[model samples]
Target: MTKILAVRDLHLAMRTGEKLVPVLRGINLNLPQGEVHGLVGESGAGKTMLGRVILDILPPNAVVTAGHVDCATTGSQIKSGGRIFSNRGRSGISLIPQDPMTSLNPVKKIGKQMVEILQLAHTGPPRALQERAEALLAEVRIKKPKEVLKQYPHHLSGGMRQRVLIAMAFSSEPGIIIADEPTTALDVSVQRRVLRLIRDLQKERNTTILFITHDLGVVAKLCDKVSLMHSGMILEQGLVSEVFHSPSHPYTRSLLNAIPRYDQPREKLAPVAEDLQSQLIDEARKYDQQRQV
Candidate 1:
């Protein structure tokens, strides 16, 4: 399969006071065309940071110390200090943020937000954009999309808000989407529904998604391939089935063991071992030292 996006030997850091602290270290990732690739890691494991790097939306203090991102769809290679160009007026890559509440404008009506996104794809009259917006909402399975459009972000439930974001993401027909823990804020039932919706949309449009999450269960359900990240490094990556059934990395095994298994209802859930954590931390420190040298 052809790669839609690729990151090679990427290193990123943040400036805290006068010293630069490393966030991502020697990272390499590839998203194949029309596939959902999960980036699974605990919070602060640099998963979200990697997504932001791909989106070219890093924080002001963040610095790309090395490497480059290649977007095959755009035929553009963005180096450490360069900007990434979008396909159309809008980005070839879009983001479905973690918190819908914060992502949507509380003051703006859903219709206005939707139209704003549609406008980026093409120049059209208000009515045309509105119609496209409605169609997009409907595509995401939002009932009475017109009514929902007239409402504000707070007017809808969590799931509905997420659905609206999903609609907006696909409105421009982006080639790749960075789904940054998109279902984390929703309830279990809602989460499942949202996941199904994402899968359906991806299949219909043949969109590639870089699904960032800490949930192994979600990865197993949704991802074609998976990358296990820790301390800003990719510990292991392969087909979801292979990784899940035969995790070669100790960290990957620890993560799988930590999950609550329905089959082993009586067995106690195992937390990631402290010793293993220490070992990984030491490895990361050593990597940092080597880079400094």
Candidate 2:
């Protein structure tokens, strides 16, 4: 498989008052063409921040303090707030943010919003644009594309809104799609449906995906490779099978052990020992050293 996106020694931090809060420490990742990689971590683990870094959408106060992000074709390293990039790469990157309700514009009709998005990325005839938007809606499995097109975002269900967001991301036909907590806002049933939609679409389009979620179950079902993150660092990464069946990192073992097992009803989840905290800190230092190499 061809390499599409490569993140080498990527680091991001926020300047808060007198202290500097480092959120992403010496992160490195590689996404080959047509591959799906999952990033798993709990809240404040810098998972979302990592996604934002790839998209060049860091918070106002945050900065990409170190490292480079190389786009496949250009071979140019784009730094924070720098313009060393273009939309020349195969199927420009797109993002499906965490929240569906707030992601869409409240006043615009779904169809209109979708149309504008497509038009911005596509330079073509008017008739073709409308047809493309409608087709995307259908691809996302939204029923009655025409009727749904006329409805506002507020009129649609949470699941439907997420579908619209997914459709919009794919509207650009992106080569690399970053979906952050794609199913977090929906009910369990809706979550399954949405995840299935994303997985099917990725396979059909041969799109490279960076799927970010805190749920181990979701990772097991959708991802081919897994990166286990904790406290702003990748604790472990490898093939999903290896990571699941024979996890090497202590943090990874704890994450798996914390999962509820159907066979053991009375068994309590194993707690991640406090001693692991120092290990993570040491790992972070090691990661920082690797960044300098």
Q: Tell me, by lDDT, which candidate is best.
A: 1
TM-score of 1: 0.97
Cand. 2 TM to true fold: 0.92
Any runs in candidate 2 off by more than 4 Å, and if so which?
73-76, 80-83, 87-91, 278-293
- Each prediction's RMSD over C-alphas, in Å, is 1.3, 2.6
Per residue, candidate 1 scores C-alpha lDDT tens digits across 169-249 of 988888999999999999999999999999999998899999999999999999999999889999999999999999999
Q: Each candidate: what lDDT? A: 0.91, 0.86
Candidate 1 has an lDDT of: 0.91
Per-residue lDDT value at 185 in model 1:
98
User: Lowest lDDT 10-mer window, candidate 1?
Assistant: 82-91
TM-score of every model versus the real structure: 0.97, 0.92
Clashes in predicted model 2: 0
Residue 147 displacement in candidate 2 (angstroms): 0.6
